[model samples]
Target: MSKQVMLAASAVAVLMSCTVNAATEIQWWHAMGGSLGDKVNEIAEGYNATQDQFVVKPVFKGSYPETMTGAIAAFRAKQQPHIVQVYEVGTATMMSADKAIYPVHQLMNDSKEKFDPTAFLPSVTGYYTANSGEMLSMPFNSSTPVLYYNKSMFEKAGLSDADAPKTWNDLELVATKLLASGAQCGFTTGYQSWVQLENFAARHNVAFASNDNGFGGLDTELLVNNKAFVDHISKLEQWSKTGAFKYGGRASDAASLFYSGECAMYMNSSASYAGIKENMPNTEFGVSELPYWPSVIEQPQNSIIGGASLWVLQGHPKQDYEGVAEFFSYLSSAKVQADWHQFTGYLPITQDAFELTESQNFYQENPGTRIAIEQMTAVTPTKNSKGLRLGNFVQIRDVVDEELEQVWSGKQSAQQALDAVTARSNELLKNFERVNSKS
Candidate 1:
């Protein structure tokens, strides 16, 4: 009895091991944390359950910059993951290191996956595409900035939650009322550079950088001190002095401020919707289009994306590439993308996915959830509004953040701070251009 039982159990164990060994494992290094990280793992689990040939292994590698840096170190050591999630700010850096990446379009084509760039939203994909119209990476979790306000705070200020401020003048009036009503802060924002500078310029149809925001050529220079941009910064400085605007830390630190009811209004990535809902279960909030300046002739131009994308790294096995292509195909499906967009509040990248979400009446039921998607594609993206592709943008953003803080702290004027930011960032860009030229 013991011998037969042992033999049968060993046979089953051997079969299980063989099945595990039969599937190709693809490593995906990502920066998603919290609820978003759960969603990433869920998608991987679903893909694994759907197929016997391939399994996607999603690894959380800290923040965006850290993940990209980790991947570079790994790539040099020939131990990189098959896929890496890179934030929009790192696009130029990734593009410059083309030799280290497997261009996603070529990867899909070589693996015989059906890929149609035209099927994706132009504004969403244009940021990651090459001059030849080749998509270098898969558009994943793409998001745009939107205004989030507390419904209760609006009510407390004798304002209607249903009527959100649409223009900067309207916002100024609202912020005054909010402060008068004893709110801790009238408004706050996350990703100061992205929301206040980059998207701010794009939404005003102004240039944040030269050379079409750096897409036209690598010889781009910073224009953060432009009149339109400086005006916005100056307004923020005034609001900060008035106790109407608070400076939360960079990169979504302000999200918690809104969620915790300290800040009455917030401007942040559309992807923050899920986190807001999850973390502030008791708070009643509303989402709306980002406010515009009424004095600007180009009042309502579109906003650019903020989240990250998946880039395929080089030096992976052929089978791994094939698996990566298959996983990408799964991700690109209408249903999957729609589900992701709905779950995460990121804009649906593909037209089909957006249509699917609409057909389901998700936006109608949710209310205000579609504003980010609308804002991202509201108008044709002019050269100035397409997106920023400045090299060393990650470092540039840090400079902007540091300089802007000086303005917030009242140590420097808005013009002085922005002028300093532009000068320092251009130096970094020049260094980037020179280094890349040699490589």
Candidate 2:
């Protein structure tokens, strides 16, 4: 052979040798950002360090809505990742995309891992499970809405930190007093419609929709116009106009207010702990349960899960699916989960991690960290209290937002806003039902 031909042959041999034990890469698309995003990368790195047969790569695609849109587009284009992290509201949309997923239950069983859905808090697992008790998506960064307060603000406003509100009446008193005491702002919240409607319904043990908030069937309709809901919204409207409550736009806008000491209290996801820890390192904060209405049927039940889950996408090669499954297995480990829970404020889905945290006294030392776990496991879930899984829920939430804005802006009564939301959300549900029907 000539010199050039020999060199080409040598290069080919080098390339072949380099491919000797290379593992298949499993892509995981997620919607986590900031500190939680970094924690995700850390977990992925730990998993990759554990094995040579699988490499898990996490890609950030923006907020929850944008990520879902991208995933649907990618699915249609036949370029879906091996794994995608979808928010809780996307459950119905994902469940209906039957051909696009490899269910997590099957993956765990096939991988022969000691996967036990029963070990998870039912309030968390039930959100993503099929009727047959198989969970479609693995609960990853599950969070519940919690009442966060500024400790110094409380003391400055002449409130005892030991005596925060336990019910709606108590909150009204506290908020009224905080306002009267001339705090910059008494209370503020993010995701007005979500915390006030969806989670608020769950915390108050009411149905935001028929068919147990759409977990039962596709024919579900929004019933957020219930008396309890209207009352809650009306009260919030009064508080807003009275300067007792400041309305931040949508989706976690109030977190900044609390972190910046502009608002005395904030209602946002528990997952904000990592960011709060960084931004307000010296800021003293308290975590408490979302207060419930005193006239409600009962005390607060478990609040619904927030954050997102790691879902296995279909149409990938077996090797890639196996790699994805193995990566999930690593995530599900008790030690990894406990560490993640410690690093991030997300509830550990597995009982082992919860117990480990208890044994380590993480909660005892952290003070308010146990509130979420306690709230999640406090009651046996009734139909209304379990969680929501409505189809086209993201669009339905948009409907809730628009009508709610009308209520907040005094363009409509609370009842009128909710009635409009119910009508519009049902239309989306009907569309979902039609599309998912098998003819």
Give me the candidate number with maximum lDDT: 1
Per-residue lDDT over 1-439 for candidate 1, one digit per residue giving the tens place of the 0 to 100 score: 9999999999998578558678777899999998889999999988888887877989999998899999999998999999999999899988998788899999999999988888999899988988778999998989899999999999999999656889888899999999889898988999999999888888888888888888888899988887888898999999998878999898888777888788899999888887888887887889989999978744588999978999999887787899999899889889989999998888898999999999999999998888888888778888878888999988998999999999999999989998999899999999999999666
Model 1 regions lying over 4 Å from their true place: 1-21
**Candidate 2 segments whose C-alpha is farther than 4 A from its true place:** 1-18
- List TM-score per model, in order: 0.93, 0.92
**lDDT for model 1, on a 0 to 1 scale?**
0.89
Report the C-alpha lDDT of model 2 over 236-328, residue by residue, as the tens digit. Answer: 888878776787777776677888887787887787766676779998888888888878856677788877887788888776777777787
Q: Model 1, 40: alpha-carbon shift in Å? A: 1.8
For all candidates, the clash counts are: 0, 1
Error of 2 at 289 (Å): 0.7
Worst 10 residues of 1 by lDDT: 14-23
Among all candidates shown, the one with the greatest TM-score: 1
